[model samples]
Target: MDSDDLGLFGPGSVTWKVHEEPILIVAGLRSLYLQSLHPRAMAGVAQNSNYRSDAWGRLVRTATYVGTTIYGTTAEAEAAGLRVRRRHARLRATDLFTGEEFRVDDPELLRWVHVTEVESFLDTARRAGLPLTADEIDGYYTEQRRSAALVGLDPATVPGTAAEVADYYRRIRPELRMTREAAETALFLTAPPIPWKLSLPARIGLNLGPPRWAYFGIAGTALALLPAWARRMYGGLGLPTTALSADLSVRALRLTLATLPRRWREGPLQQAAKERAARLAGTPA
Candidate 1:
């Protein structure tokens, strides 16, 4: 089904159309954040072999991650019209094993979302003062154009205009909340491995990074409660930078808890996680 069919663009209601909601902004942020944590999610685009280096790879990686996580399958991601190609550079289409011609860049809703997500990622990274070069930024946009064309956009209607992009977001940002199941699944999926007990293979994976719980709350209530303090702790403790699952998990738990209004710490997600932890530890939650 088309994004329009899903009430993404907000059917004919001015209030829905005119307002730019936090859900959409958060959607963009969440897509980028998840991609940063799961760079391998972009396996299709990054490993395309056809388009090698430049911003295209980064954008593709970001888009691929968003597609896999949000849609739950690679084939579905492809069917949703997610792919990348170059504009004014070179052709980079690949042939599937079934001998079908595949173009990664099209102007479909998926590509638009991908581009927006990638742009948001770059913007956030830039804000964080990461060590990316200008060449990288140019490469990202080049890839962006390729990705846009993969879906069906005629290059002309690529929403190159800022107002146009903003207008589009104004229409599509409200219906993006996480379902309870989705929230829980995402919470777990994004978490780092718990070392409660594991086999050699599992331990090997755990050794690759710190446990997820260590980083989960850095940006949520913990951040809000003690902004500078949290930053200092992350800096001084030298916590694992790759443990985003934990950081996001903590944020999700805190936000979920905060939704209770009266008793902040004893919310649904908090209770659930605590209960799970207790069961695992053989103690009361």
Candidate 2:
């Protein structure tokens, strides 16, 4: 790690604070739920993804990409992004609705994935008791356009603020739906196949009992955190109190995770980046 390199965000950036929170695990899942609602996005994943067979590996790789963008050196981040772009360049998905095979990496589909992802991170952090003001929230979105750019999106074409994201969602609502792909994806996320091997704590820890239900809780919490409108698309029309429950659940989840030792909570990438930031701050010209 280059102690002097602050990556894309540096220490002062809002993104550094927002993405560090453990609650963003829920946020990542929320983004998947939200992104799947787009027909093209769902089709792309349903057709091209191997998430079902390699669920944990897929999750780790996704997390690594996100962490690299936030914490790795600029070159590392760019390299990771380039790898993704090349992979996506080769993949195509056939959307039955469009009756055509389209590149999965199209800007429009990428934009939807990008927007929903950042929105979920911002929303989840705030709801889990992070103290971000309105301007900071806007700044987070503005800063994330750099992330959008790395994935081959034109920064100017992506939403740059919370207001813009909200408006974009409203305009795109008509195109969003719970298609067969999205439905199956959502079902799998709620109860994803667990890897047969697990340590002792994972088996009975978290007080959630079985591993399956434990993961279901995590997924359900993410589902609960979805915007009510998105929830409705998935037949989550039960009650208005779901919002309150989600808020409570997220807060509790964050609190529980916080109890663990720092090493347990913070991954190597995050720790290395923060150390670099601190090292640079302590040195003089």
Predicted structure 2, TM vs. truth: 0.94
The true-versus-predicted C-alpha distance at residue 53 of model 1, in Å, is 29
TM-score for model 1?
Answer: 0.33
Badly placed stretches (over 4 Å) of model 1 are 1-29, 32-108, 130-143, 161-163, 192-285
lDDT of each: 0.37, 0.89
Q: TM-score per candidate, in order? A: 0.33, 0.94
lDDT over C-alpha atoms for residue 243 of model 1: 33
lDDT of 2 at 263: 93
Q: Write the per-residue lDDT of candidate 2 for residues 1-285, one digit (tens) a residue.
A: 455778899889999989879889999999999999999898898898889999889999999999999999888889999999999999998988968999999999999999999999999999998999999999999999999999999999999988999999999999999898899989988877666565444677633347666778889889988988998999995467998898899999999988989898888888888888878888532
What clash count goes with each model? 19, 0
Model 2 CA deviation exceeding 4 Å by range: 199-208, 283-285
